[model samples]
Target: MPDAASTRAAPTASTASSTTLAIGFEGSANKISVGVARADGTILANPRETYVTPPGTGFLPRETAKHHRDVVVELARRALEEAKASMRDVDAVCFTRGPGMGAPLTTAAACARTLALLFDKPLVGVNHCVAHIEMGRLVTGARDPVVLYASGGNTQVIAYNERRYRIFGETIDIAVGNMLDRFARVCGLSNDPAPGYNIEQEAKKGTKFIEGPYGVKGMDVNLSGILTFYETYAKEHLGAGEVTVADLCMSMQETVFSMLVEITERAMAHTNAKDVLIVGGVGCNLRLQEMMAIMASERGGKLYGLDEDGRMDDRFCIDNGAMIAYTGLLQYENGETTPLEKTWCTQRFRTDEVLVTWRSEAVKRPASCEPPTV
Candidate 1:
């Protein structure tokens, strides 16, 4: 893996402006994403490819690492090509450095370091969770909002405080997506190309609710019982008539999203933040968004769902490199860039490590003109 400390001497002002490109890499879980974005948070190109690990499998660090090594270059090349740029045009490379599988994280870091060295560019390390929040902020322009992040690896309610992003509530066990995926597999839904998508589609046809675990206690969550119950029910009752998959899907979505809504509402109340932003892959669920909107509206708060682009923009919902690149640019502008010697990867990094609000004194110059970097 690449060492985060090696710094390329600061480029001349002209060179910096001419080649100021931000590349974001996300190689966590099953997806390997690479995106290029401009300093103004405009996404140049977002390209990602998903890898499928076997079902009922826990985190296999070594296997994931190998997957990254095999696909990072291809994904990066595709992203650059889509952006209509080359290595020479890039000034900085940003990658998800931690809070993920060590093997995959190292693989991505190694590739990023090699590219930085080859192109003589600065390397920026980013937190995956922060990238999700930054994406919401950039897309929706929500400032100082309560963030609800629900994904395969994380489920938390976060608020910005004293320059850092703090977690007020989170899952005590598996993530919401993880639970869904596991349940899907148990229900024999993994045979579909996209099990989650399939489940969502089936859930739309479901009008009845079956008994399932409802373990929402305060701001914290417990999903193990729900998952276990689903597993046993699927085993014993899958062959029974009138037990449609749609009912199961509907029940699961309602139960989990209701829990999420409760926690997000509590976070908003606790923080006194009127703006509530939902992020992470699970944020794409329309039912979840509807519930959140209703909850926020009832509390006399506004809910920003980041749907300006479209109602079903899968590109933005899933983890992407563009979010990481844009976030790195924000940190860089704010003088939050960590020294090469002090930068390190953390598999369990808390979002509080990086300050939430960073102001950049650097003035924006025309694309044709050079801007000074301080």
Candidate 2:
């Protein structure tokens, strides 16, 4: 953490600028990021560091936390420097409060709490998933789109209703990204950048698609069955020259992404929502965006987060400090702030647990889908 007293002299009230700024810390998972943003939704700077393990291995919590603690302060300083701001210029401090590894979450919360206490700024504890959604909305200008929140730890179809981002459908077993990572391990894929990114690249070269298990039950999807099938048969197929890694990757992507698109379309039909917004780290995949765009266009709707080339900018798509900062600023503008006593981090924060005070108006369900009169 940057020392408020030693680094930069505190700005007096007479010297403080009128611009409202907030700094955010994020280390919910392997990545530790710091960001600075203005009240007008402009992200001044976002710097992040990822803790990547070797091939066929996943990042453990202890090592990930250690990595976060080591780089958070430097990243914070870099963010502030890139933003050309100081602690005294910031009006609030924000941190991701949950739905992540406990150790890494605590590491970020500790840095955030220290900064908030030292600078006497209000602390805003943002939910990790909500931050993703809000950031997607900010970037794409989608007001009431049906959001597909997909990441390593989460996979859900969501929409705003009654002061909450209600979960319309979600994974019942492992997350989509988790399945990809585990499958990549089975295939001995490198985790240098990201396992899923490598899988996406490999899938592009696949001419054959091996059949995999698809487990979609009503509003929920299950990926563990598919993962288990692949794990059990991958080695045999490779040894027998029946399937290549690229073919297996294509099979996995097709099966899981189809399930995701199915649930998202179902949610949109149920909610009568026309706009579809994709968020989270896995949302950076071009294939997922392309599938979603096709679904939206079929319904006479539009897709957010994709440019003319069906590609997404990774800045807002992946986990980052800017999302937390921007979402926290939204909360702060709504007169919501986490007090020092209530600023604890958690490992399991749900999306619907938040009362979205900023968006007070309820999304009215279409009468065609509403219940009949009593």
Candidate 3:
């Protein structure tokens, strides 16, 4: 738990040319990342720490928050040192406000409030999903692209609609990343780096595709069924040599990633947008990137993510405080600062809940790609 302290008026950003610096804190889940970013889209520093649970265990909320509390001060110091900037240079402080583990989100929020008061800087509460999209656009030069946000706790196909990042599709149950992590545990894979990464490695050697229950209900997906069926199949067939971990990994990824890409393509079609940005923890998957690239090229568009250059790594793609900082800069510059009394984190913030005040201009829709209205 973070110690609470508070109060101050945030500095206002009057123009785009103003070189405002922001320090961000993120502990939405098992990973806690501290980072600094400039309004000009420059990443000053991004230092992170991830909690690794045992092979068959999941990361508990309280434990993860404890981890964040133990390392936040040290991480913040290191991030500032790497960026060659001091707290005095920061104009605002940002932290993940939600769509994450409750305890962890609160831990980061409390820390952010403390820092904001200490430095007399503006405090900004950033939605985790919007942070991912803003960071993707900042890192890759994508202009108003349809976003596919995939992570441990969230899976949403989003696009700008009516002044908001509308969620055209999302998971009805557990997220695809959670599905993969659970599967990895079932297969006795290591969760050291990330279960998803290890599962991708196993998927690469797959010789067969054991078809599991594929869930694609219109725009929404249900990954819970996939995990259930796959677990049962593994238990029933692994000892009999009928199925292997490789096949299961490949099958699960192929099935779920295809659903994610499909929903993203639908969003693109609906919005007539040509660029698609893949973000979040699970977006680092190479197989998903390949499928998405193929789909985008066929539609005369391009996919803007995955580790090809830097999308797959922790620096830009994975969960990080930099994403929060970068996004908070946009909001703070747009006058979206949070009051200390109202600086609370949520565990269920939706992508569409964000008003997206910064991106005011609408993207031009292609005539040929106009969505078919009912």
Candidate 4:
């Protein structure tokens, strides 16, 4: 049932069936990933290769692209091996084409084009942000969800509307994941394993919630200003004992995730959707999930986290090829595909820019799900 606050009908999926087998290539940023999936929601194989920069340094487009070009073929092969499937089983080749680092996206697209030519498969160009949202829906089983996408390069509150997933709110500057990773670098943390996970773990010991600038303008959130304030504090007071690192980390998560939840809740109210799905890299944060759950419960809504049995923090949370594969399969079912000549990657693709012809007005909820307890 739709929330009383909203009279919108939940999207109902078509019962029609088709071959869902798709192989996706994702190299939007520092990670290169490949995924194979079936229409029945079975993930056959998902493989990823990451580029690690030195401590205190951020990822560069050139370096990231070089890394992807070097390993993409091998990674794709490995993914196939893991799935126990071959090129003959794949129905289409999909790749992330936009709203990411240009160099990496181009690398992935070029490789995808090559694969499409070789395998004689249909080529599908996927929007990076939409991939995140669709992947969340698949893995979490959240029907008609109000999506909150938070990653290194994006922060958006999205809802499925007439033929599109419309953005209700977004960041004006840096994204939430970028803000966290940059701060981790400022705090002298290595970008080897992960940054946000390290910060979340450290924040568990924080006793005081350091007050920082909480930025929210209408439905959007601004982390740039608050990040600058924290950076200054880190330079001056972090070493001077004025504030502990834990304090900053804890407070940062609290402030930013709260802003995200607030905007997502607003989208929920506007859309009348009772299910909130948190997607992207920052969506793996337990702190963010906890805060979102609290907000959703207050409004008699349920919060769905795409942890996928706890793999989201590492595999599903970050940019991955499987998401592209899954979303591409959805698009393919809607008679959508790109020609080889049209497979250009982009660095700025907005969420509302694409037409969603895949879903219908068959109101539904998460299967086997109950309403959140107050």
Candidate 5:
């Protein structure tokens, strides 16, 4: 966990072709990543590894930390090599600072600090949620869009305002990804690649629509009760062939994603926003993207969830180091750095806590003049 403060002295400006380069580390959960990026939002190299547990189990903090420590150094070397750059080319070191598991966050923070001190470069601590939003905006060419931020430990509808990415709506209980993972364990789904991916594949084959809890409490959503009901129903009906796992998966996805879309649409309407941007691990879901695209089109707006190549690229969509590096590059250009003494990690960091001083004021667009689709 690193401090999200700007109290440190600025490093010498890099005159390397008028663009600054940065290396970033990310081990917030089971994923460990290292990436290099330029201040102009160009990703030089981004590589990551995931620490997955076997079926019927979830990853724990201690083992996940060990995995990160074992592979992070190698990944960093690979990233720098892929970028065809050395320590001299890197202007700053950045890492995910908080709102994640403590042990994993510590591993990334320690790696980032070592790199920064060894190279005598500035250190920047980036917010994981903010990194996602910044990367989404950069890649999609979407300006001032309402963001739907969804992941394993977080669920929120966010929009940039004043000097912060404000959280307009969020989950009151468990994140949608967490609920899906827990249900996957109960159904004995494989975690080799990811539980959510397996569930999504199974859901595609499903046809029956089983009734489940729709937990929408005003602008917030509650998914814990829905997970409980699905777990109990599976135990009673799965063994008797009364319901299939695919049906349960499909039904649960529909129920929960509907809740997300509902809140995100409300945020868009409240803000009069014409574009919607989806960012997070769960944003990789094609079904979710389709649903969001439909909602955006119906409102005479566009959805910014796909890459420039017109598909979900996991390197930017999932938790990766490039997002951290790119965001840190932005902050550094704005004359912000985290002091060495304050570069400690925390697990309770909030999304709205960071001060985003890089961007100008958000511009509102007329509904008839929406930006071209990405």
Candidate 6:
């Protein structure tokens, strides 16, 4: 990690240009999202490429690496084009440094470094988890709120404290999104593109809600056992064509999301934070949003749910470049940028490890310029 003094400070407000462009790269999980943004947090262009690993087969690192190296160039080019800009116009290059698959991170770092060298710009590394939280704040304007992050590789309840963000609670095992994805595979859901989105749709049609284990050790949680029980029950009973996949999906959502709601509510009470924000891919669930809404209302606090239309919008969610770029920009502004010599990726980077120096400076405009919907 680079110390604060080692970073190159952002240009002072007086010297900062109005149109400084930042390019961000996100190659975590199976998706590659590239973003271009202005200094003031306006998204210019956002494009993503998703890679598919065959169902039932394990994640092959080398295969994933190859996918990243092959697809990122086109994705980056398209994103730049969408912004009506080129690589030469970019002022900085940002890439997700870690808390992801090592191969994918390496590929992203290499691509970002090449772009930085080619364009003669600064290369900044970003943490994927922090980018999610920063996106939440950017869109919702919920300052110093407790964050509930549920994703393929992470399940954490975080709060900004002291100089760094602390993980009040997190998963001891598999992440919530991974559990959902695994269940989707077991239930024969589509592996094409978005598996989680497919599962959410299936869950909507479900009427029955089955119970599962709810592991709550203090603030941390575990969903693997619940998934195991669901899988076993489905195999033993549903193999005979008894239970519908919709029912299974509904039950899974109810059990897992309820656990999330419980922990988030508890964290709010413990921290006394007046606002609650939810991030991560699983944060898009309607049921999860409803539950959090109820909890926030009951506690007399606001809940900023980052659905498709929140301040940041879905463009920031689902692993896009804007959030990464924005977070990278924050890191750069705060003098936290790392040198190329010491940068590395961690498959399991904890949220508490990094300090939270970024602050919400302004309320975002409405998601769109159109009149508010009735």
lDDT of candidate 2 over 1-374, digit per residue (tens): 22121111111112222277899998999889998887677788888888999999999999999999999999999999989899999999999999999999999999999998898999999999999988887777777899999999999999887678888899998889888988899989999789999999999988887888889999899999999998887877798998888988888898889999999999999998888999988998999999999999999998986766768767778889988987888788778899899999898899988978777555688765443233
Query: Which run of 10 residues does model 5 get worst, by summed lDDT?
Result: 1-10
Which wins on lDDT, candidate 2 or candidate 6?
2
Instruction: Go through the candidates in order and give each one's C-alpha lDDT.
Output: 0.73, 0.86, 0.82, 0.80, 0.85, 0.75
Model 5, 1-374: lDDT tens digits are 11111111112122222368899998899999988888767788888899999999999999999999999999999889888899788999999998899999999999999988888999999999999988888777777889999899899999876667878899998888888899999999999788998999999988899998899998899999999999999999999998899999999999999999999999888878878998989998888988898899999999975646556656577888888988888888888899999999989889989888787665563453343343
10 residues in a row with least lDDT, candidate 2: 4-13
Q: Model 1: per-residue lDDT, tens digit, 1-374? A: 11111112211112123235688888767677888876665677777766665554444678767777788898898888878889888767888877777777777777877888788778888999988887777666666678898887889998765446778899998988888887777766652345566677788998778888788877799998998987787678768866777888898888888999888888777766667888887777778888888888888877875356534345666777787877776666555554455446668977766655453223222342221232
Q: Rank all candidate structures by their lDDT, best first, as comma-separated numbers.
A: 2, 5, 3, 4, 6, 1
> Model 3 misses residue 247 by how many Å?
1.2
User: Taking the tens digit of each residue's C-alpha lDDT, what string does model 6 give over 1-374?
Assistant: 00001111222222234477788988877777788877666677777777776664335567877887898898788778778888888878999887888898888888888888888888888889988987777666666688998777888998765545667788888999888889888888876756677788898898777777778878888888999999998888786877788888888888888888888888777776667888888777667777788888888987784445533244455677777877787767666666878567778676766655654333222233222233
The superposed Cα distance between candidate 6 and the true structure at residue 5, in angstroms, equals 34
- Which residue pairs show backbone clashes in model 1? 5-340, 99-347, 163-356
Which tens-of-lDDT digit does each residue in 274-365 have in candidate 4? 77888888887888888887787788877875345533433566788888887888888778899888898889999888887777664433
Model 1 stretches with alpha carbons more than 4 Å out: 1-19, 53-60, 191-193, 306-312, 338-344, 357-374
Backbone clashes in each candidate structure, one number apiece?
Answer: 3, 0, 2, 1, 4, 2
Our tally of clashes for model 1 stands at 3
lDDT tens digits, residue span 211-288, model 3: 877788988888998899999999999999988899988888888888888788887877777778888888887788
- The TM-score between candidate 1 and the true structure equals 0.85
Candidates 3 and 4: which is better by TM-score?
A: 3
> Could you estimate the TM-score for every candidate?
0.85, 0.93, 0.92, 0.90, 0.92, 0.87
